[model samples]
Target: MKNIFKLSILGLGLALTLASCSPEDPIGSKVTYYPLITVNGDDFMSVEEGGTFNDPGAVATIGDEEVPVTTTYEGRFRGQTYNSTLGTSVADLYTASYAATNEDGFDGVATRTIYVGNTGDLVTSIEGLYRSTVTRNGALTAQYTDMEYVLIWKNSDGTYEISDAFGGYYDLGRAYGVGYITPGGVIVANDIPTNNFSFPGTQYNSGFGAPSEITAMTVDPATNSIDLTVVWTTTTTYTFQIHLDQVQL
Candidate 1:
């Protein structure tokens, strides 16, 4: 009886292990990787200084903790460093942690979907209509709500021009006081405000700024979707991660 019970337990363990394996997802029962995003019908690749391949992958941050992803590059995890070379295709849904990387590299978990590619999809490439919300901190007390404007991006030359004909507003105010004394009365004071008006707030605010540099771009062979990250250097540094489902017209 004892031998039968031990055999039964061992067989159940083996069955469970076999059930967890699949030919389709040899890595596990389910595949884990990154989603792809395409822009302008192009597959973006992560290249080096001379546009050389960098073994694209991704990164994710949950709360204040950053969870680095595993890819074809050398990465450190749990204080141990390891290198991941390119190999067979993996799963799309990563283990429920903080982050996952497929072919795209160093992107936030929130920005992961932008990298997931679809066939023949190209990204917007920081051109055409792009709106950014501008906020000021420390000394400057102002907020520009959803500044909409037309943008012309020069990816190769690394420059961009913006035209937001609609001018914004700057609040201004002042104070005045007057005092009068009568023969038999004490002093009387009065203050009056004189200027009060509004501006049309539409003017040609033309300026040229360095266009965002495309640090990385890639496309899946299966799905032609492209994923890219454009880093913009302005008075206020800003980063825009782009994933275009289709090429911009």
Candidate 2:
């Protein structure tokens, strides 16, 4: 009976080991590897407004073997849609995406961003009311929150206008005058969003200087947020950054 029990335990262990074993692949079977996609040119391209654009496509590969890549593009240019056409008129933002599929039904994808505009113009669309966050010297400055409120939109004359040029930091008087009065604003700001011919900010008034100048402005592509920096006689040393988040378009 003791010998029989030992033999039974050994047989169970062997059975478990056999069940856990993986079957070997047939001879000459190929191993599957996912494709790696690499874009050909610059990930971001700056094409002039109303200029001709030719897309330099991307490439995909599995190990050293090259695979066929399928490419598609979508752009924002005066509400125009073109997936294969090369003409780009007016200021626009385009995303060209490349995709490849392997035999095992695995897909690899990559994209390129194209900004179409003339030099020194707003690249992407920013015409709308914005939820603004003003930061001075890396610290949140909420005092001028009211005056810092900004609105930007297009005009019939094909120009742009901003509510406040300073973006924020003045107009310490939302209620009554305490520190300073609201500074006057800019009338003719920049180009239109369609032609990259204009500016930012469509409403409100803030800042100490009578005319707050927008020294620099840019949009962060990743967050789809616009950042504006303003400087004036009162705040000449450093400028406050107003991060504009779109509230209404």
Candidate 3:
């Protein structure tokens, strides 16, 4: 049995060597050491509305040798779409990527998140933790009960930007996840106006339609909840209802 085990180990090592060795190498050699990038500041960073963003940048190294890194501040979610000047008075999400290329022409990249939000009186009044649920086409899509996974906070002139807009769906309802929030404009008589919001990993049928039929949009902390109706896969009928129930800050 011991001899059999040794033979198996020898066979596995041979297979690994054969897999690793290339025609050019003729030996099992690791790929060229690429530069590793590290972002300097917090992975999740924010800039208040009407404020400026100054990236702390990043560093790159190949072992002990320093290597040049290429950095970018993306203003849009769709790849590297860069707008001339990033607007501050809107609920916008962005990304910061640091990349270092090796001599072998391979790229090593690191990514972080950026949120543009407002810390206004109206926002503070409505920001809190909550029970949550989401539905598409009148069918349940997601929910959270025992744990208060829904968090809504912050604001902007064009939209009130917060943690998670999907409650607990697209990003586990975490602020630092792949999700961000945008409830647009100022509130008058506690009426939430129509707004368009988009997030990652969703393929909506048409455009992300308006949040038209809001059942309960309020600023009262004790019994605060939001019932938002949006058009989803079946366009025009307002087929999606995502809500923040029993809000508590």
The candidate maximizing TM-score is 3
Query: Each candidate: how many clashes?
Result: 35, 11, 2
lDDT of 1 by residue, 1-249 (tens): 999999999999999999888466445364344433222222332211222233334444434344555342221100122244321121011111123444344343321111111112213222232232332221222333333222222223332222221111111100110111000101111110211112111122123334334344443323333233344455765443333232332
- Give per-residue CA lDDT, model 3, range 1-249, as digits (tens): 999999999999999999888568467668578788888988877777568877787899987888887766674432334343444554345667788888888889998777654333332344434566766566663333323444444433333333433444444433244433322222223333232233223322112333432322434334456554443333355454566664221
Error (Å) of candidate 1 at residue 15 is: 99
CA lDDT, candidate 2, residue 113: 72
Local distance difference test values of all predictions, in order: 0.28, 0.57, 0.52
TM-score of 1: 0.19
Quick one: RMSD of model 1?
25.9
Where model 3 places Cα greater than 4 Å from the true spot, the runs are: 1-31, 76-90, 123-132, 136-216, 222-225, 231-239, 245-249
Candidate 2 local lDDT, 1-249, one digit each (tens): 999999999999999999889688777877888989999888877566567777788889998999998877675323445555545663445677788999899899998877655432234444544456666656664465534235555445645444445453443314333233323333343432433333333222332334445656665544555677765444345456777765421
Candidate numbers sorted by lDDT from highest down: 2, 3, 1
C-alpha positional error of residue 144 in candidate 1 after TM-score superposition, expressed in Å? 17
Query: Which segments of candidate 1 are over 4 A away from where they belong?
Result: 1-208, 247-249
